[model samples]
Target: MKLISQPGPKTDFSMLLLFTIVVLTMPIWLAPIGAGYPDLVQKFAIYGLFATGFNILFGLTGYLSFGHAAFLGVGSYTAVWSFKLLGMNPVPAVLLAIVTSAIFALLIGYISLRRTGIYFSILTLAFAQMCYQLAYSVLTPITNGETGLRVLQSDPRILDGVITSQTEDGGPLITNFFGIDMTKTWETNIFGIDVQLNAGFYFCAFFLILGSYIAMRIFRSPFGMMLRGVKTNQNRMNYTGVNTRPYTLAAFVISGAYAGLAGALLCVTDPLAGAERMFWTASGEVVLMVILGGAGTLMGPMLGAGIIKYFENILSAFNKSTLEGMLGFLPENMLDGTISVLSLFVGEGWHLTLGLLFMVVVIFLPGGLVEGAKSILLKLTGGGSKKSASAQAAE
Candidate 1:
């Protein structure tokens, strides 16, 4: 028997350096891109982590679980409960979120992994819908129904010994890291552009980088190779006496832990947990993020998350006036006609635009944005080296 040692830190310096630069300079680059707002920035980090985790199972193991959001919702519910009954600091809340979500994932994974293919996907989806229905109805006692669970001013924090959630100024106390309030934001004008940097965004960014690093390690590990084998040919692995179910289940639980952490971060940012977060559509959004950004690639999830969120937040916010200002250089008649047609794809019709974009990516760039970009770059550089390089890298 041979033991496989985990790779050393030095093996991943490039990955660490890349993410470090990106995370630290977000306030600089993200502002120009219309996603620098603290709230949106936090979403990018949270959903990026969520998609990255999902890729671990779906990308590597080829086992798509639509119930992953169930774990995320469970994490949010647990975190809020921790804050409500335990303490105001986010540490315990986040820890409890991970633990509870992991347990939930374990149970769901156990049942769903009993089958494969579309059957597996259906089982996961059914489990997620059941969880959502229960949370919205039967579990309303704990989940707080459709109104969502939130931090209240009168709840007792038995662990922290603080009786009320009010400050001397009479506003409700916000979630914090020790003494630093997670909601605190630092605003400044940089090169004539406004940048809103929040403590909570940085906190989420830290976890995103940490999660990405962990994922990169997994991608380069023997366990990840086995999972890939399961994806590529599970029958061959089974013929060789490999218990692929355990491998897939481990991947599923690991991904759920990541989703749980992401969910906890969401609550840490806003101190609220809604049953809507567990809906199957939320799971589908992460799936689209993973697919749009390049599932198997390390940076794909982040890119996909940013792009999808950009469309959802920034593009959807554009009104007729904003559109007119941007296209004012055109003839008034032409502009009116263009806006009339474009109006259906922005704002209230943003889903149409999103659907179009998804279709474009799926049809023309099946490997997602990363692979498409790689192909374009390779073409500019000239030749067959791109295919050979990608094939070699995959191997």
Candidate 2:
């Protein structure tokens, strides 16, 4: 038995520092791009965590599970239930959500791991769809069916015996850490830009940093190597007396725990749970995020999540009038034509733009955005490297 050493300290520190800086400064940098709003930023952190988790299983083990949304939904439901029965504090809610979702993932992974390839994918998708239907119909009592489950003042909240569940005018209770409200936002002007420092966004960002660090550790560990072996050739490993199922299952559970944490953050920012979170499309979207960014790479999933969410929230808000305003400098006839053609790629047609982008990435940069950036960098430095090598050889 041999020990697996940690990732090189310099590499881990630099990567973690860069990631932390990028995430923490998002509000300042993203303001010009119209994505600095608290709500949107919160979503970026949450989904980034989700995609990073999914990358663990799909990227390392080569086992794609489409039913991760079931774990997500379970986490959400568990968090809301915790708030309803326990207190308005997010700590208990988040802890319970991760535990419950991990257990759910364990059960699902145990069964799905029996097969491989597309059969495994289909099985996971089937399980997710079944969970969706159950939440939407049969499990209505717990999930609140189509209406969704939400925290209410009438709920027991035993942990907060004397704390008021309503505002001065009687509004619903809000989730908080200690006395700090999760929905609280401090608005300030920085360098002539409107910057919002949100409590909830920072909270989610904290978890995102933690999740990324843990994921990095896993990627550098011996267990991660075993999972990679499973991806490379499970049959060969099996023949060599290596039992790969346990490694694959562990990765699945860890990934599910990450999804659960993201789901809990969702409810922490907004105390509600819905069946829609468990939909097949939700699972599919995370898959797209991982693929669009770069599977098997740490920061790729987060980048993909940010791009997709930016399109969904900012680009999708563009209307005919909005387009006309931006293109007002053009001639009357030209402006109208431009708006007409561009209309299909913005606002309601944002998905069309996403599809085209996905197609281009798949065709040109099969390794996603990370690979594209790397290729560009190589081109920029390739000539200088060649010249230096020739000079050294002549000497």
Which segments of candidate 1 are over 4 A away from where they belong?
1-12, 161-170, 385-395
Error of 1 at 87 (Å): 1.3
Candidate 2 has an lDDT of: 0.90
Put down candidate 1 lDDT per residue, 129-231, tens digits, no spaces: 9999999989999999999998776777566545334354558768877777899999889899998889998888988998998999899988999998999
For candidate 2, give the lDDT of residue 270.
92
The local distance difference test score of each candidate is: 0.87, 0.90
Please count the clashing residue pairs in each candidate, in the order shown: 0, 0
Structural similarity to truth (TM-score) of each candidate = 0.92, 0.93
lDDT per residue as tens, model 2, 1-395: 12224559797899899989999989999999899999999999999999999999998999988889988999899999999998888889999999999999999999999999999999999999999999999999899999999988788888764453434346768887877899999999999999999999999999999999999988888788888899999999899888998889999999999999899999997999999999999999999999999888888999999999999999999999998888989998788788999999999999999999999988898888996786667559765465456658778
Error of 1 at 230 (Å): 0.4
Model 2: how far is 323 from its true place, Å? Answer: 1.5
Using lDDT, give the best candidate's number.
2
Candidate 1 is scored at a TM of 0.92
The C-alpha stretches of model 2 lying farther than 4 A from their native spots are 1-7, 161-169, 383-395
